[model samples]
Target: MRYLPLEEITEDMCLARPIFNGDGRVLLSNGVKLSKNYVSRLKEMGYQNLYVYRVGEEISDFSTPISDQTMREAIHGVKDAFGKAAQRQQLNIRDVNEIVSYILDEILTNPNVLYNLMDIKNHDNYYYHHSVNVCIISTLIAKEMGLAREKVKDLTTGALLHDLGMVCVDPRILSQPRKLTEDEMATVREHTNYGFQLLRSERNLSILVAHTAYQHHERMDGSGYPKGLVGEDIHLFGRIVAVADSYETMTSGRVYRKAMWSHEAIRQLRESAPEKYDPDVVAAMERSIAFYPVGSVVVLNTHEEAVVVDVNAKKITIQFSSGPRVNALMDLEPDSEIKIEERLS
Candidate 1:
């Protein structure tokens, strides 16, 4: 499905998927016919765009970054570097450094576009999709933290390589859909050190960037692995990545569970246990995340459905097929009669 802006949502476009509100309730059934109220409600809610579920490639590639091909090329290009980095008996920091450099080049050259491209990382190719999601999560966090453009590039690079050490591990462990045993989890935790050691051999890469790959999984509460250093000791880049990593991991679709809606996902991060992540970072990440991101379908609590068309200075205003735009995305306090239903996959 393609996302349609609220202004662009017409009676003509069809609903290919069911839509729901944050409460896990269905608001619109699939195949429901469209109406004028759909547009009105969506606009009232401030959802800028609507997703057209069943579309051709022509529509799918209609985005700003226009870098799917470029990204695919880069993804494969870096795969070779990762292979080289992984094969050495001793860590080869050069590979990690090159990998990070390439990623930074991509982000710096096209920040605004790729920056926005994060919203659409759900396409095929999990590896590339993973890269895109990491970029989105990291960029959002960095931007909200008020980092300068150059620093944004550095964080983006760190995020792209944060999992480089994982590439050295067995694919079976990384791709497993179920929970891992303690032993398996231990092996899984090796990525941090392995990544750091590998990057240690490289040249000119900043310690901050290298540390991101190694320490991102390390938590603030010291519940993390590979030398579970607690808060403050964890590098700033590492800390930034921790929130970004979890945000991407929990919110995105997995073999085990459906991807949670962005709003719900933020709520989970806010309410979750151990206080493993920094609370401030969580809040920044939430504001940066596109809860009702442009071009996703949503249903209201009023039994009305809309497609998010635009992001206002505040709320996500949805363009509905039958309802009016709600006043605020933050005021998610279920309007007894109005609410968002579902996030289109």
Candidate 2:
């Protein structure tokens, strides 16, 4: 099913997925037909559309964002904890360790949870969710980079708070749809410095993490903002967060464009601007993400339909229950047997 904007809402639109209140009461279950009330409640809650199957290919004129209820709850819990931490007027070392440990535990036990969050782009909860996504990606990248456990936890906290400066920026700039002019983007760039300042303001905050806010956007070629530190000059926490943040932002749906299908996003990253991003970090991210997520449907080269089963670092894994498998890899033999037609955007 595709998502449809509220402006085009109609009774014919069947609920392709579950619709529920923030409290978890089901307003409509999967397969339930849409009605005026269902649409109204969605609008009331600030949602602009519903996911529905159209004539043939799934389509959504409305920006139907992927939702992970568990992630939302986790972010809320983290937000509240931080609120408490702020009111207490100090970040206790033990408490900070506990928070990082919990985040690491979640990542270690449920890796897919992190990948799923990478797909969601809730405008209402960007900061908390982006923090969670960054932590997951940074920790994974750190592990791949061979950092030790203690170092991993420290870097993870830094990744989680990398965007903490956005809290100080004008909300209008953050949410603007049209591309920012140079002047606005310059202010946007200050998020790194602002984030550094915010964390520095807290006497008890972790200085390493605070620095991540400053250095996360720095590039190896010294093209990044706030500081143009290159290569070894940049902090490890900053470097890790840079890769994670870009991947998360690219995959998340935006008001201006439908989210790039995972495969396409990965392709772009792999090609790289060279000299800008570290080649090693790019490799790590490619291995860790599923460009074509499982449960997503795509057209196959065989001129038939299929659901994506898995996404590997080198090539997407598909299960062709109905036909022969295609050679999606080898350049000597690019799959004539089957090809993914397109992602259900």
Candidate 3:
């Protein structure tokens, strides 16, 4: 299966994976044959791309660390909690902690899961979806860095609540299709302080979690907002969440811009490491994310196109252009010349 732009879709193309609604209900199920009508409907609903099966393309299960049920639950939980935060009302701290704990449990259970951010997003639920995605990516990065169990939990909790301040921002500013004005940009940047104040009010919560919301926007070069903290001054949780936030924001499409490819986002992170972002954190994230995720169609150096079926320790399993499958390291030793040339959209 391969990701195709909506305009590229034709009749009789089958969906490789199910698309879910904001409520996590199946909008369209896998293996469903598509028609022009179906494509038009999805386009009307704001879907720009889809995963469809190509002839002779091998289907692979794209596993995530958490289940869809858990994802929906977390999204709902964030929506409720963040709404309360925006109002300056006391949050159900216990409930929020429990939800974070549950997510941590799932990540810990699937310690080696190669994270793929494939959650369906809509305009109304972007903030909720983004928070959950950032939390997952941050936790996986912490795991990759070999952080202690307790530290991992703290980082995960902090990551989940990092964007709490966005709730206070005006929807009009966020939804603006054009670039924000200087004044509007300043107001948008105040979310960090807003979120920090809200989270810091909960005495039962860790101060680090509040700091996560506060310092996530800070840059290592003292160019970040609010405090403009320099390297080593930024808390570990803050740095981790910052990297996750950057990645999720880049990959998750917004009204103002198209979503970037995974490899491109990773490359941006790598290039900015130790300057705009923490080098160690960027490295951890790079190791955690799949460069060429499952179902992605890639052209090899040999001029053959294939779909990545699975990624393993030292190599990836791919269904070659010839229709046969092979488990070979696409970038090393014997298969050194067979590098991935480009990832198809």
Candidate 3 minimal-lDDT segment of 10 residues:
325-334
Q: Could you give candidate 1's per-residue lDDT for residues 120-151 as a string of tens digits? A: 22222344446545755676666667777676
* Candidate lDDT (C-alpha), each: 0.58, 0.61, 0.79
Better of 2 and 3 by lDDT: 3
Predicted structure 2: lDDT: 0.61
Question: Tens digit of lDDT per residue, candidate 3, span 32-98?
Answer: 8888899898877767778788544447565677787788778777888887887778888787788
lDDT tens per residue, model 2, 1-345: 444565675777776655444323344566766688867866655454455543333422211112345444445544653454335444444555566677666555543332522232345555666676777777777766777777787687777667766756677998886678898888888888867876777765568878887998888889887879988788867877888888777766656655566677767867764576777887877666665565466666556555554443334445443445442322111344556767653
Which scores better on TM-score, 1 or 3? 3
All candidates: TM-score: 0.67, 0.72, 0.89
* Structure candidate 2, residue pairs in collision: 3-60, 5-62, 299-341, 301-339
Q: Which window of 10 residues has the lowest lDDT sum in candidate 2?
A: 57-66
Give the residue spans of candidate 2 off by over 4 A: 1-70, 77-99, 110-118, 309-341
Which of the two, 1 or 3, has more lDDT?
3
Residue 105, model 1: Cα distance from true site in angstroms = 8.8
Ranked by TM-score, the better of candidates 2 and 3 is 3
